[model samples]
Target: MLLTPFARVIPLPETIMRCRYSVVAACLIASFAATAEQESIERLEVQGDFRRLSVQTIAGSIAVVSEQDMQRSSAQHLDDVLSQLANINFAAGASRGRFVQVRGIGERSEFIDVINPSVGVLIDGIDYSGLGISSIAHAEQLEVFRGPEATRFGTNAMAGMLNLSSKQPDFRRDGAFSATVANYNSWQLSGMLSDAISDQVAFSLTADKQVSDGFIENTYLHRKDTNDIDELTIRGRLLYRHSDQLQWQLIAHAIEQNNGYDAFSLDRNRTTLSDEPGKDKLSSQALALRSDYHGIVGADLMWQLSWLSADSDYRFDEDWAFVGIRPGWEYSAFDRYQRSREQWTLDYRLVSDDQGRIADNTDWVLGFYVSGRELDLQRTRRSGTRLRAFDNNLQRDNAAVYGETSTALSEQTTLVIGGRLERYKDDYRDNGNLTIQQRHSMWGGKLSLNFQASEQAMIYTLLSRGYKVGGVNGEALSRAGDDGLEALLQQATFEPETLVNAEFGVKGAAIDGSLVTRVAVFHMWRDDMQVKGWLNPELGPEFAGFIDNAGRGRNYGIEMENRLVLHPSFTLHVSAGLLKSKLGPYVTQAGLDMTGRDQAHAPRFTYQLAGDWFLSEQLTLQASVQGKSGFYYSDGHNARSASSELVNLRLNYQLEQWQFAFWSRNALNQDRGVRGFYFGNDPRDEYAPHTYEQWGEPRRFGVTASYQF
Candidate 1:
């Protein structure tokens, strides 16, 4: 099938544009620039006074969450912080927020075999994509990029990127300790210490532990803690300064998790009938080193190297109830999966020094990246006394070279261009003596034009291309037909997916820095879109699912974010996003026409409103409300989640060296669903298809106390 082109843009009403321009003009005329700068001293420092933020993606599409914002929301995990944004969603897999989707594009399933991630995750310069175990207990800032990052991140960043930075070691000794107590038998403890060990070296260490009685209840086992939470994280870093022009940094981190996996029920409630519950355990360790040198022939050079290893044990009950629930039916079943992975990465870059018109007002950057990963996965399925086993080993290697340059065409106009050439290779080997290899070479890049319309306003446009590598399915060998195993393997392989995106945006600070606003419109066209589907044969009870290239698709959206400082002690923030995603003309393997179908997890509209009020020097209040429209769960099914809204509040009291806070999440106790499926699990119904859902967290209130020394 041939790819389809995007439709023409729909023009907006002229009156709307006139009204926006009028508002901008009025704000400019009535503005009074503030001469004095305000600074915050809270643990999660507020960046309200800052008008500009930096991110490593397309210009004007960056969203930054300050430390104070995180604390106000009482964010325990990454999802807690991300939930307040627009055009962003996640799938609740074994744990919370295991997979993230951006702008209606991302992975929705767990990594069962060889797969490529659409979103890229980075923490303190180390890659952690698809591994949501990174602790945010001591983060300094969170930056989210909402479009393809081909030039900087390569194939894995086809959708977007999320970057988290921790507080750096300082010259003075500082430490903090915090504790929290909440409902549902939940509690947490965290600590951080940083000190200057010598004149040339500084060290920092952080640790966190959290425990909670999970929300689900296994009625058959008569226990509420069957699906509980137990997690721990530790990190250490050292910074060494050889001289004013040279520096080196080393970091090491580890995470341990032992969470429950007993989610879902036949009745779509919190109570389950499974007699045998399962566990989700993970242990991971990573190390990274970075070196930087300045004044290298009027340029700067930096190098980074990292290594990571992780082992996971994920098991669950396949049958929702005991054997006696339906006599003479198929016996109960269980599935256990053990996975181990090792990865290594290297990145090096050189940047030219900025010279005032000496180099024609131009700046340039060049970089090279390489990564290697190996995975070993084993699965065992048990049906009563009978057992079936499968095992596979896969290896992936990637290398890329990229370059970008920006030059001033005039005093108000600047042009930027960049490109990346990448090569990817994958090898897979199964225990059944079957082996397959795939290789792909592709190029992607960006072209942008930025115009400074005024001292307080700027507008920009960008055209970018992103790509995801292809792979072969290792599980399809079990269901090979008369065509033989090799032929089936060839049919199971999928090609690479690619997208071309175009965006136009305007950003400015109004009311003399008291207000900041951003508006953007984007359209993306995708080719060889990858989709998952299940196949059942008439000859046997075996069922197989695999990823395939689903012809083409298109997505268009508009996003806006505005922050206004109504007064010195009062602030308001609002954000909204509207999206339309549709699959092009395509025929599925089952001979079904999927044209005009909405993509999975693609919400139509999302919005948020947040406010902060400072009553006194030692007391403050904050509240936020976020909502999302219902969306399809998958491309193969029509099931969807219901529209829902969530409210959160926080109160804070601070004194010299001490802080106390009270926070509530889901204050209304909205029982919204975060994950859903349409597969039958009850034998009493003869395995009929029925919708099952995993609900989001209920209302919870907590108190936190912290001390600095």
Candidate 2:
């Protein structure tokens, strides 16, 4: 379907001419504007509790939840609160922390090296996307950024980014504890404390635990559903201010989880039985240090170094025979598979002010990065303890220097130009066998014209380029199909992914800060896209897969976000996104036509709306609704289709030193389906069934109360 703005009454030719004229006029105006002037914007904007946050409403999209919002909710896990976001999707597997899918590209692909996640996650300035680094503790604020961003965050930022800020050490001695009991025998306990060991040194600690009976059914196994989950997290941060110009912090965090291994069964009718009643454990630990310095050659510098380690012990029972004739008939598949990982990263930055020097036309930044990862695995058949050990490692080194400056070309216009040069390398291995070592270097540039159309509004047009690094496949598909399936799984070197993005947008605030709105339209063309594909059965389709070069793709979309304050006690927040993603023609396993296919799991339309009504100074009520209209789960034309709509409600009341809140998700009891496909022994036989289904959560409600003291 072709999507165009609803109010395009003008003819196509005239519209194109008008847009070209506008661009020419904008450039002309920017050329005669003022010279260099230093301008800095705050990094974060905060509203009342539970509302989204951003630095520049139109520059990027950000979602933030302060401590107040965290304390008012009954949610023990971070994903619980994130579920309310329309673009944020999760898949519950054997692990406690669900797989995060943001902006449609995060679904599982056939290649492990191609981490399709366009989103980058950061905790305390440290990137956290390694195995077993999902659970976070005592977060003070969590920020989510959407769209192409490479200037602020180096790489891996294809679609968006997620940054989490931890609570800082308090000079005052304080602590609190809380517990809860809910349906399904669910229970939770949390505590936090902070104190100053000295005037210049301080520290804080936090710990939490959660246990619940999962929501599922298994008639074959008469006990409660095996989706039960238990998780614990601990975190600590120490800050030292040695002198007036320098400050540093040391932080450590850990997570331990024991969960049931469950994958939805093919029983067709029963919604339960999707969860396995098997035991699985996953854990991770990390430590990092950050330093901030002033007066470095008249510039500011920030540096961070981090090291992390993780381990997973997972085992499960699988159906050996195709017939379900016997009772308690179970075959152990991955009787036990152990995985361990270690990673280290170093990041440094330097920022300088122009200050009317060098024609006041220059402002720049210098940055560098180094990261490494290693994985060790041990596996054995469930029926026996004959262990097989394998080792794999990945090392990436990236460096970039970017300088973006806005020279006031005129009083009403600003011209901005910037560029970045980056280089990266990846190395991968299998079972102590080195497969491939690849390296690449790329450069990106950005140019923008910002015009203050009026005091209340600003219009900007930007043309920029961004790149996502390529990596070695972490999990090869060779183990998936077997007998012959493993042979088709081939390991091939991959090239980098790059995109050229063009955007035009407008931003405005009306009614004296009572209303704000922003709209933007963009088109992105990506090259050398790395995507997972199926192999021909003649090659012996098995689980082992290969990484191959995929053709290019194009994405065009529009995004709009608005906030309106109707009264002192009432406010509304709204956001919507429409996207069309299509890949170029490429040869399939059967050599049939498969062009113009939507990227896997990327939705065409997604939107969100919410209203807040403050009943009184001590009480507030909120109603929110979010929906995803169109999504395709696979690249194959015959793959399964999936979509969802969810509504949520929350009420908060505060009195004295205590605060309380009641909240519910999927409040309207929507039926959400999570589907996957399994194609066996049939590449050319497109007539075979290649889809599976598992239902998502139903309506759930809970209340929370917390004491400040």
**Candidate topping TM-score:** 1
**Model 2 lDDT per residue over 1-45, tens place:** 011321242223232333443334433333322121323322345
lDDT of 1 by residue, 551-577 (tens): 899877777777788999999988888
The regions of model 1 sitting more than 4 angstroms off are 1-58, 355-358, 480-491, 536-543, 589-592
Candidate 2: minimum summed lDDT over ten consecutive residues — where?
Answer: 1-10
Model 1 poorest ten-residue lDDT run:
42-51
Clash counts for all predictions? 0, 20
